[model samples]
Target: MTREELIKNIKSKQSFLCVGLDSDIKKLPAHLLSEPNSIFAFNKAIIDATAPYAVAYKPNMAFYESLGAQGWTALEETVSYIQNNYPDQFIIADAKRGDIGNTSTLYARSFFEHLGVDAITVAPYMGQDSVSPFLGYDSKWVVLLSLTSNKGSHDFQLTEDKNGKRLFENVIETSQQWASDKEMMYVVGATQGKMFADIRKIAP
Candidate 1:
């Protein structure tokens, strides 16, 4: 979706909430396990339950990947369900993929073409070349990982460079060169609330 569309949705919903659907098979409601499409069944119910309050739904890739082909099928069905039922809600594949040029292009095609998610989380540690492949799609988003909400984020993301800029500042600055704000967004952790001022300086 375009930046204006996303902003409009956020305003209309009065929410910026992106519900993370990192559903685990072991944690699913007791009865769903017997169904052939249990994962999708559970996801559809969760989506229905939370649809009123959420403007976006994020499915972490690992949970699905672990189940191999079955997990992938469920994920695909989940995306299709959201698109058909709640077309306005943004869908994100929290894959966190990062690779070299050619491989990154294939990865982008897989997510954008095959699975049809609205956005995908990418890693900027591979630099601009690894990220540009995903920006080739219109209205699709590349959410580059910047400051994370983990303890280890301080280890590198906060490390000062020779220019005195932190690593994440450089990630934000460099990745913007590959894509405009319309197709790009930085993942800032809620824990990094104070650093939002710094992030805005680069993004705004």
Candidate 2:
């Protein structure tokens, strides 16, 4: 979806909540395990239960990848369920993937052409060439990991470079050169709440 469309949807729904679908078999309600397609069933239930309160659903890839082929099947089913049922809701594959140029193209195709998510979270540490491939798609987004939520985010992201710019700031600045504000977004963590205002200044 376009940026305006996403903004419009958020306004219409009066919510900006992105429900994280970190579904785990062990954590699922015990009753669901007995059913066929238990993972999809649980996801369906969760989506149905929470859809009213959220404008988007982010299915973290690790949860599905851990299940091997069955997990992938379940992930596909879950995505299909959303597309078929809740078409207006934005779907994000919270797959923090980034690699060399050729591989990144395949990664983009995997999420955009094949699975067709609205956005994917990606690491920016690999630099521009690795990131630009994902930004080439239409009506999709590349959410670059900037100042993250974890305690270790300071290890690199907060450190100053020779130019006196922090790594996260440099990420936000450099990634902008690759894509417009509409198609690009930095993953400024909620923990770094004050920094978002600063990011907006640079981003705007």
Candidate 3:
């Protein structure tokens, strides 16, 4: 989805909520276990209930990927269901995938062409070549990992260099050369607090 489309959805719904569909089969309610595809069934129920209040849905890929082919099938069904039923809602495959250029190209094709998600979280640790391939698709987004909320984020994201610029700051500045805000976004953790003001100085 384009930035304009996403913004419009938020306005129409009067919300900026992005529901995370981290549907772990093992954590599913016992009642749903009898369903032919429990994962998809669980996701459908959540999506239907939350669609009215949310503008976006983010399905963490690891949960489904761990289940093998069955999980993948459920994921496909979930995406299809949302596309057909809630077309206005932005769908994000929260797969923090990034690799060499050739591999990234395939990853891009799989998410953008095959699974047909609007955006995918990408690990920018591999640098621009690893991320550029995903930017080729119009209206598709590359949500780069920036300042994460994890405890380990301090290990790298906040580290400063000889020039005194923090790693996350450098990431935000350098990545802009690859794509504009229209097609790219950064994942800034809510816990970052005042650091968000710092990010906006560079990103905004």
Best by TM-score: 3
- Flag regions of model 3 displaced more than 4 Å: none
List model 1 lDDT by residue over 1-204, tens digit each. 778887898999899989998989999988999989889999999999988778999999999999999999999999999999998899989999989789999999999999889899998897888888889798999999999999999989999998899999999988878888889888999998999998999998
Candidate 2 residue pairs in clash (backbone atoms < 3 Å): none
Where is model 2 more than 4 Å wrong at Cα?
Answer: none
For candidate 2, give the lDDT.
Answer: 0.90
lDDT of each: 0.91, 0.90, 0.94
lDDT of 2 by residue, 63-137 (tens): 999999999999999999999998888999999998977899999999999999989999989898878889878
User: What TM-score goes with each of the models?
Assistant: 0.97, 0.97, 0.98
lDDT accuracy of residue 121 in candidate 1? 97
Candidate 1: stretches off by over 4 Å: none
- Candidate 1: 10-residue stretch with minimal lDDT: 1-10
Q: Best to worst by lDDT, what's the order?
A: 3, 1, 2
Candidate topping lDDT: 3
